[model samples]
Target: MSPQLGNERRAADGVHSGESGRFTSPVRSSRLSPLAAPAFRYFFVGQVVNRVGSSMAGVALAFAVLDIDDSASALGWVIAASSVPMVVFMLLGGAIADRLPRAVVLRGCNLVQGVVQTATAVLVITGYAEIWHLVVLQAVAGTVFAVSYPAFLGMVPILLPVEERKAAFLLIGQATSAVGILGPAVSGVLVATAGPGWALAVDAATYLVAAGLLLLVRLPPGDRSNAKPSVIGDFLAGWAFARHLGWVIPAASASLVFNALVSGAINVLGPVIADDTIGSEGWGLARSGQAVGVFVAAFFLAKVTLRAPMRAIMIAFVVWCVPMLVLGTHVNVWVLSASFVVAGAALSLLDLAWNLLVQEKVPEEMLSRIMAIDGFFSFVATPIGQLAVGPLAIAFGAGRVQLGCFALAALVAAFALTRRRITDVRLTGGPPPQLTG
Candidate 1:
C-alpha cells in the first residue's frame, strides 16, 4: 500500500477541494478509487495475494511444528529462531531500503522468500523435516522480511500522495481482513487433508507471483546525493529524529511490553490450549472470526470522522487485553472466537491510526528509517518472550500464564494513557504539529 492524489488537491484552508470548492477525492470513501492508479493496483493485488498465503502459512507452520514435536518448547524455539534474526537485522534492512529503490528491494526479497519457503515445503513433504530445518528456514525468511518491511511501510507515500493515504490504508486493511478470513479456514482444510507441506507450498507460489507483480510497479528514482557515509550513520540520523519525539519512546516501550507478554502468551500457548479443547478446525474459525472483526472495524471507521483519533486509539489498546482474558478463562471455541473479534477490531483500529500518525508526522526522506527504528525497538524483546513463554507455560500452566500476561498488558495500556503527548494528538489533515519532547 501506497497511494497518490487522484485528480484532487488540498486547498489553502487545508480542506481538500476541487474547482467547485467542495471535496472531490473519491479515494476517501470509495473502496475501488485508489485502484485507478496502475501502480497501486498492481501493488494491491500482489499484497492481497501474498497476505492470503502468509496467513495460511502462519497456521500451517504452528501445526507442522506440533506434528513434529508436540511440545510448546519446541514451537517456541522455531518461532524464536525467526524473530531473533529480524531483531538483529532490522536496522540494516531499513538503511538499505532507504538507499535503494523500495520496489526493487521488495522484489528481490520476495524472490528469496519464495526459494526458502519452497525448500522448507519440500523438506516437510518428503517426510525428512526436522524442527531444526524449520528453524533455519524460518530464520532466513525472517531476515528477508526484516529487509522488506521498511520498504513496505515507506512505499505507500511513494505510490500515492498524502491526501489519499488514509483511504488507501483502510482499503488495504479491508482486503487483508477479507483474505485473513479465508486463509486460515483454507489452511485448516489443507493441513487436515493434504498436510501443512502443501499449505506452505502455496505460500511459496504466492511469493513468486508477488515478485513478478513488483516488476510492473514503476516508482520515481530515489535521490542518493545526500546519502549517509555509512549504514550506521543512516541509522543514527533516524534515531536522532525519533529520539526527540516524546510519544515515540513511550509508545515503543509499550509495544515492546505488549508484544513480549501478551503476544508471546497468545502465540506460544494459545494453540496448545486450542488443540486440547476446540481442535485445529475450530482454532481456524476462531482466527477467522478475528479477521471478520477487523473487516467490520475498517468498514465502520472509513465511514466515520474522528475528532480525537489518538485518544480513541489509546482506548483500543485497552480492548486488546480481551483476547488473553477469554483464552485464559474460557474453553469453548465460540467464546474464544467472539472475544478475538473484539480484540481484532481494537487491533485494526490501533494499527491504522498509528500508521497514519507516523506517515503524517515523519518526513518522507526519513520515513523508512524511522519505521525501521520503530520496528527494531518494538520487536527487540519478542524473540526472548517467544522463547521463554513455552517454558513458563510448562511451569505455570497455560491458563495462568495467559491471565498474567493479560494483567500486564492492561497495566501497560494504563501507563500509556497517562502520557499527555500521546493522548493529545489529533489528525485533522493539516501540517503535523511539532511534537513536544
Candidate 2:
C-alpha cells in the first residue's frame, strides 16, 4: 500500500505515543532540530535534485525559444505557459495532497515528470520542436508541479517536529537558492556546448533520481482519510481558516503582493538590467550573490533558535525591499549583485519563519489545503507581474518599473506588519502537534 494509505491506517489505530511530550513541552534544545529527521533527509534530497533539474531545463527552454523563433514575445508566451497552469490548479492540487499520501503523490509526480521531460527531449532532438510544442510541454510540467509542491510542503510537518518547521524550511530555502546560484551558469554552458536537447535529457534523469529517493522515504501520518469534501468546499475550508488567522491572512496577502511584483522584476527585468548594465556574466554573478546570502541564512537557522521567529520574518520581509530599491538605482554589476545578495538573505529569513509559523499554528488536517490556497493566490499575481513588467518598462523604462515595484512591495509589507497581534504567535515546544506524526 502507498505510505499515505498506511499513515491513514495508523492514524485510525490511534498512534499518539511520544507525540504530546515532543509537542507541548517548551522548545528546549535546538541540537536535534527537525531537519535531522530521516524522512526529511529523503524529501530534501529529492527536492534538491528536482530544483536543479528544473533550473537547467528552464534556461535551456528559453534558449530554445531564441534559437527557434528569435522573438522576445514568443519567449514570453512560452515561459508564461508554464506558470498559467499553476495559477489554475494550485488550489485543487492542495486538495489532492490533503486527500492522498504525500509520498505517493511526490513519487508519482516525479515519475510523470520524468516521462514528460524525456519526451520533450526526444521531440527537440528530432528537430520537430516548435514554439507551440514548448508551450504545451511546459503546461504539462506545470500541471504536475501544481499537485506535487503542495504535497511536498505539507509533508514537512508529518516528517519533522512542528518547532523545527522553521529550520526545515530554512534548509530548503537555502538549498533552492544554491541551485539558483548554479543552475543558470550550468544551463548556459550545457546549452552552449551539448545543446538544449541534452539539457532536457539531463532534467529527465534528475526526475528519475528524485523518484528513487522519494521511494526510500517512510512518512508517519496525516488526516488523509477524513471525510472527503468537494473541491470548492475543501478550498473554502482552507481559505476560511487562513482568513480568520490574525497572522496568516494578512501576511500571506502582503507576501502575495510583494512576490508578484518582485518575481516579475526578477524574471523579466533582472536579465534586462544585467544585459544592459553589467552584461550576461554580471547577471549570473548577481544571482550567485543572492544564493550566497541564502546559504548564510540557512547556516544560522540550522544552528540557532530565534525568539519570535515570525516577527523576525516580518522584519526581514521589510528589509528585503531595500536591496530592490538600491538595485533599481544602480548600473554596476557589483552593486546590483550586492543588493540582490541582501535581498536573498532577507528572503531566506522570511521563508524559514513563515513556513514555521503556519505549520505550527494551523491544524495539520488543513495544512495541505491551506498551503494550496496560499500557494495559488500568492503565485497568481506573478504572471500578471511578468506580463506587465515588459509593457511598463517599455512605456516608462526598466528603471521606473523597478523603482515602482520596490516601493509597492515595501508598502505592502509595511502595512501587513503593522498588525499588533501578528507578533504573538509561536511554536509550542511539546511532543509536537496532534497530526504532525
Candidate 3:
C-alpha cells in the first residue's frame, strides 16, 4: 500500500448502540450522498486534490532518481531513506494523534510536506539535484507522513456519521481511483516533456491547497480526557489491546511480507524493467490501468455487501501474483497493463474489507494507536526490502527476483488462510469482539 492507502482509520461513533457499540441501521441514501455534508465535502475535495498530486509524485520521484543516477540501488537508497523513518516514528505519531486535534495535526504535517517537496522541486528543476538531495528531502517528507497518516485516518469518524462512514470511504476510494487514473497518465506526459521537477512542483502546490481547504472543515471536538499519562503509556495500552487480537498481528505480518517483497519488486524493479521495454510513458499507462481497476471495484463494492470479507481479502492476495508474473516475464506493455488492472481490483477489495472490519471492531478512542501498530507492522520491513531488492536484482536478475517475490506473496496469502482467527471472523452487527488478556 502507498502511504496514502496506509493512512486509514475507522470506528463506530454517534450511530452505534450504547455500551455495545453496535451499528444501528443507517438511513438509506445514494452512495454519493455523503458529499452533501459540508465538512465531508471539503475533506473529499482536499483528498482528491492531494491524491492526484501524490499519484503523480510517485512516478516522478522514481524517474527523478533515475535521471540523476540510473541505477536501481540509487533508487532503493532513496526509497529506503523514506520508509525507515516512517517505520521508526509511526507509533509515536499514533500516540500524538490520539492526544491532539487530528485536523490540526494533519494541517501542520501538510504544510511541512509542502515545503519539503517544494525544496525538492527547486533542486531538481535547477539542475542541482543529486541522489543525496532527493534522499534527504524524501526522508523529511516521510517523517511528516508518519505523523499525518494516523491523523488522516482518525479524522474520518469525526467528519461523518456512523451510517455514512462506509459510503464516505467508498466515495473517497472512488475519487482517489479516478485521480489515480488521471494523475499517472498526466505525470507521464509531464515527465516525458517537461521533466520530473514540474511534477514535483504540482505535488507541492496540491499540498498547500489541501492545507488551505482543511482550514474550512469544522469538526466536533474530540474527547481527550481519557488519554493516558504519557505517549508511551498510550502506545503500550494500544499494544496490549492489539496483542490479544488473534487476527491483527497475523494480518499485519502478512502485510509486512507482501509490502517488503511484492511492493518493492513493483516500485523499484518494475520501473527498471519498464525503462528497458515500455519506457516511462508506457509505465505511467500501466499504473493508470491499475487505477482503472480500482475505480471499477469501488463502484461495485459500494452497491453490494461482502459476505466473506477475509476470504475475499485472501483471494486478492493471490491475484497479486499475476502482475508479478507478468512483470517477471517482460510481457508486452498491453499485457502488463492488463495484469495490473486485475491486481489493482484485488487491492481495492482487500483494502475495503480490511478497513471496514477494523472500523467496526476497534474502539473509537483506540483507533489511532491500533492503526499505528498496524502501520508499523505493515511497513517495518519495507526499507529492508527496498534496500535489498536492488542488490538481489543485480545478482539474480530482475525477472528471477520478481518471480521470487510472487512466490513469497502467494505463500503468505496461503498461510493467512489457515488461521481460524482470520477466516472465522466476520463483520458482526453487535459490539466488537472484546480484547482478551
Candidate 4:
C-alpha cells in the first residue's frame, strides 16, 4: 500500500496518523503524558480541588455527628440520607449529562453544591445544626453528586485520546488519592482545632472554585435531540442496556450487594471503632494509611498495563476481605492501619480497572448513561447496609457483624469471578477510531 493509504488506515484506527512519530498537535500524543492539552489541565486541577474537599468532608461529617449525638445509629442515619437521593436521582443526572454540554451540567452542579455546603457550614458554626437538619441538607447535596458524576465521567473522552484513558484515569486516581492522604488528616486537625464547620466551609469554597474553572472549559456540543422526555423510561433503558453485558452486569450486581454490606458497614463501624478503641485521631491516621496506599497504587498502576481485565479485578477484590477481618478482630491500631493500606491499594486498582474498562468498551454517546447505571448499581444498596449495620452491631457484636459483611463481600466477589467473562475478557486498549478531522 502507498504511504498515504497507510497513514489513512492508521488514522482510521485512532493512532497518531502523522507521517512522523511526533504528532504536530501535542494533544493527540499527550494522552499518556498529562497537561499537554489545555482542557485536561483545567479539568484535572478543578477535580483535585473538589475531591480534596469532598474527602475532608467525609471524615469531618462523621465526627460532627459524634460531637452532637454520640449514637452510632445517628451517624448511620446521616449517611443513609445522603446516599439514597444520590442513587434515586443518578439516572436523571446521567440522562441530562448526555443531553447537554457536560461542562454546563458540571458547573451548575458545582455551584449548587457550593451553596449547599455553605449552608451546612453556617448551621454547624452557629450551633443550630440539628441531626435532622443535616440529614435533610445532605439529601439535597446528594442530588448534586447524582447529576455531576455522570457529567464528570463523560468529560475525559471528549478531551483526551482513546489510548490515554488508562493514563487519564490513573492520573485522576493519583490526584484523588493524594487528596485522600492529606484531606482526612487535615480535616482531623481542623475538626479538632476550629470545628467540623470550618472543614465544611472549605469544601464549599472548593466547589465554587471548581465551578469557575469549569466555565473556562470549552467542549463539543452533545447530541440529545433524539433523547426521550420521560425520566423513568430513560432510567429503565439505562438498566436494560446495563444488564445484557457479561462483564458489566455481574460486576454491577456484585458491587450492589458489596456496597450494601461492605461500604455501609465500614462507614458506620469504622468511626465507632475509632471512638471506642484508638479515639478519633487514630481513626484519622488509619484513613491516612488507606489514602497513602491509594496514592501509591495510582502511581504504580498508571504505568502498569493489564491484559485480563476481569480476572485482575477479582484477584484484587479478594484481598479486600483482609482489612475488614483485621478491623473486626480489634487487632492494634498499627495492624489496622496496615490492613487499610493493603485494602486501599486493592480497592484503588479495582476502581481504576473498572473505570478504564467502561471507557474502553462503551460508546462515547452512551457513556454517561451507562456510567450512571454503573453508579446506581455500585452504590444503590449502601443505604441499606448503613441503616442495618450499626443496628446489627448494637444487637450482635461489631466484630461478628463486620466479619459477616466481609464474608458476604468475598462470596459475591468470588461469584463474580465465576463468570466466563471475568477471566476471558481482555482490554487490548484498543485504538478506537476517535479523532475528528
Candidate 5:
C-alpha cells in the first residue's frame, strides 16, 4: 500500500505512531509559519506577481483575438492551441522536474514565457499578428508551462517545513484569488485605453520579474546519486509506485474525468453563456465574485484543521453543481455570480487539500514524478474538454452541454467517496498544534 503523508509526519514527529504508522495526534496539524520562510516568501511573491500578470494577459488576449476576428470560434482555436501542448508535455515535464533543479527548470520556463509574451506584444503592436502566429507562439508557451507547473509544485515541499506547507498553500490560494479579482478588469481598461499590446508588455515584464526573483531563491539540488539517469526510467518508477505502492495515481485517475467536465464547462462554456444571458460586465462580476469567495476560503483554510481531508474535499465539491444549475436554468446575474463564488471556494479548497497531502506524504525524491503523473492525467483531458465543449455546445444547446458537464462533476466528486483511500484519510482532532511534522 502507499504510505500516507500523515505517516511521513508521524515518522518525523516521533511522538506518536500506530500500526498503520500515521500520526494519530492533532499535533500534526498544519501551521501558518511557512510564510516567515525567506525562500518561500520570495517564491510566494513571485506567484502573486505571476497570477496578476497572467490575469491581465487573460483580458488582453481576449480583446486582442476578438479585435481581429470578432468570433468566439477563432478565440477557441487560439486557446485550444495553447492548451493542447500544455496537456501533451506534462509527463515529460514531470520527469525533468525530478532530474533537474526545479528552480532552474521553473526559471528557464518563466524566461521562455517572458520571451513568448514579448513576441506576442510585438506582433500585436506591429499589427502583424495573425491567428496562425498566435497559435504557434501560444503552443510554445504552453509547452513551457508543462515543465514549469510540475517544477513549481515539486519545488514547494522543499521550500518549507513539513508542518507549514498546508498553510502555505492556503496563503498562496488567497494571494492568487485576491489578485485575480482585479486582473481582468484592470487589464480590460488598459486594453481599451492604451491597447492590448501594451497590456501584454506588462505581462511580459511580470514574467521577467518573477524569473529574476527565482534566481535569488536557493533550494536543495535533488538527490541523484542513487537514481537512474534516464528520465523515462524515472517516470516509469513513479508510475509504478503510485500504481502499485500508493493510492495517489488512483485518485488522479478519477480527477482526470473530473477536470474534463469541470475545466471546460466552467472556463470555456460559462463565459459564453454569460455573454449571451447576463452580459459581459455581469460575467466579469461573476468571476470577481468567485475570486472573492476563494480569498475568504483561503483565510479560513489557513486557520482550520481538516480532520477528514477527503470528506472536506467531497463536501466542498457539492457546491460545484451550482454552476451547472445556473447554466442550465439561465439564472440572473445575482444567481450566476453567487454560483461562481461558491464554486471558486470549492475549487481553491480542493487545490489546497490535494497539494498539502502530496507534499507531506510523498518522499521528496519521488514527489515531482508522482506530481507529474498526477497532474498529467489530471489535466491531460483539458484540451479535449476545451476543444470539444465548443462543438458540443453547438450540437446541443450550451445550457444542456453545461448541465451535462456539471452532472459529470457532481458524479465525479461523489465517486471520490467510494475510493476508500480518499475517504480513509483521518486528521486527528483537538486544538491544532503549532508544529509537529
Candidate 6:
C-alpha cells in the first residue's frame, strides 16, 4: 500500500481500539469529585437534611419509649433491639455497596426509613404503639440503616477528589452536628405538644427530601468483583481486612468498646437520668449543649488540618472520659450539662480524626466493607453494653457501675493510645495510594 493509505488504515485501527476500550472499561465518569464539582453540594445538603431528621426522630423515639416503659431495663431492651441488626448485616451491606450504585442504595435506604418512621407515627397516633412494636420497628429501621450507612459513608471518596476528601467528611460531620443542635430542641417541643408521632412525621418528611436530593446527584460505578465471590468469602475478606490493618483493627476496636459503653449508657439511661436527676427540660438542654459542643469542634476541625492523627485521637478519647467521670460525680444538672457539652465537643473532634484516618488508610473499593466492619464491631457490643448497664448498675450499683465503666474505658483508651502501633499514624498529606491497577 501507498504511505498515505497505510497511515489512514492505522488511524482507523486506533479509533476502533479506543471505542472498544471505552465499552469494556468498568470505571465510570468521576465528574462529581468532591473538590472539583458542584454535585457534592447536593450530596452534602442531602446528608444535612437526613442527619437532622434522624437525630430528631432519635430523640423522639427515646423519649416516647421512656414515657411508656419507664424502667431502665425495659429501655435497655428497646435500645438493644435497634442496634442488633446493624451488627448482623454491616459487612454484607458493605459488599452490597461495593457491588451496586451507591446513590440507588442510599435512596432506597432513606425510603425504607421513611416508611418505618411513618409506621411508627401511625402506631403512636392510634395508641397501638406497644413497647414490643417499637422494638420490632426499630430493628427493621436498623437493618435498612445498616445498608444505607456504609453506602453513604463509602460514597464520599467516590464523590470527592482524594485531596479534598477530608474537607468533604468535615463538611458532612459539621452539618450533622449543626443538625444535632437543633433537632433535639425542636423534637422536644413537638414531643411535648403533639406527642412523638409529630416528630416522627417530620423525620419521614425529611427522608423524602433527602431522597429527592440524592436522586438529583450522580455517583460513579463501584468495584463489583464480589458478584463472583460466595457470601462467606466476601464477608471473610471484609473481616480479614479489618482484623489485619494496623490502623483499622485498633481504631475499630476502640470505637466498638467505647461507643458500646458510652452510647449504651446514654441511650438507655440518659432519659431516666434526665427525668430523675435533671428533669425533662434538662434532657433537651443537655442534648443541645452537646450538639453545640460538636458544632464548635467541627468548625475548628474544618479549619485546621492535623499532622498527628493518633495523638489527636488519644487526646479526644481522654477528653471523652472526663465528662463521664464528671457525670458520675453528680455535680447537679448545670454541671452535668456542662460535662455533656464538653463530651460532645470531644466526640466531634474524635470523630473527625477517626474519619480522616479511615478515609486515608482504607482502599476505596473496600471502604464500605471496612466501614461495615467498623460499624459492626463498634456497635456489636453496644447492645451488650446497654443490656449489661441496667443489670450491672443493679448488681454493682449505679455509682460504681458508672465509675467502673469510666475507668475501664479510660484505661483501654489510654493503653491503645500509648501503643506504638496506634500513636504513630500521621495525616497522610494526600489520599493513600489508589488501589486500582
- Which parts of model 4 are misplaced by more than 4 Å? 1-32, 225-237, 432-437
Name the candidate that leads on lDDT.
3
Give the C-alpha miss distance for residue 298 in model 4, angstroms. Answer: 2.4
Clashes of 4: 0
Better of 3 and 4 by TM-score: 3
For model 4, residues 16-68, the per-residue Cα lDDT tens digits are: 34553222333543334756556777888899989878888888889888888
Candidate 5 residue lDDT tens string, 172-209: 88888899887766775677678788889989999999
Q: Which stretches of candidate 1 lie over 4 Å from their true place?
A: 1-29, 307-309, 431-437
Sort all candidates by TM-score, best to worst: 3, 1, 4, 6, 5, 2
Candidate 2 backbone clash number:
12
- Tens-place lDDT digits, model 1, residues 1-437: 12222221222122244543234444453666667667878888888888878989978888999999998888888888888899899988888887787889999999999999999899888889999999999999889889998988887766655666777888888898899987888888888888899999999999999999988887656555466799887777677777775667667777787777754777777888888988788788887877888888997878766656666776777676677887788778788888878988988888888788887777556677888887888889998888888888888888888889888877777887888877786677663333222
In angstroms, the error of model 3 at 127 is: 0.6
Tens digit of lDDT per residue, candidate 6, span 190-212?
78788888888888889989999
State model 1's lDDT. 0.79
Candidate lDDT scores, in order, read: 0.79, 0.70, 0.80, 0.76, 0.73, 0.71
C-alpha RMSD (angstroms) for model 2: 4.6
Q: How many backbone clashes does candidate 3 have?
A: 0
Candidate 2 lDDT by residue in tens digits, 1-437? 11222343222111122433233223442533544455677788888898888767766765666668754456667767777898799988988887767889999999999998998898787888998998898889889889997888777766654455556677677777788788766766777677778888889999999999998776555545543457676677666766766666655666677667766676656665555566444555565666778877687766655557657776787667665565578777677778767877887877776676667666666777778777877788777776777677778877778788877876765665677666676655433233322
Backbone clashes (count) for model 5: 1
Off by over 4 Å in 3: 1-27, 431-437
- Please provide TM-scores, in order, for all candidate models, with all chains considered together: 0.91, 0.84, 0.92, 0.89, 0.86, 0.87
- Off-target runs (Cα >4 Å) in candidate 5 are 1-32, 192-195, 277-280, 427-437
Instruction: State the TM-score for model 1.
Output: 0.91
Error of 3 at 213 (Å): 0.8
Off by over 4 Å in 2: 1-36, 69-72, 122-128, 195-197, 220-225, 276-279, 302-311, 318-327, 421-437
Task: TM-score winner between 1 and 2, please give it.
Answer: 1
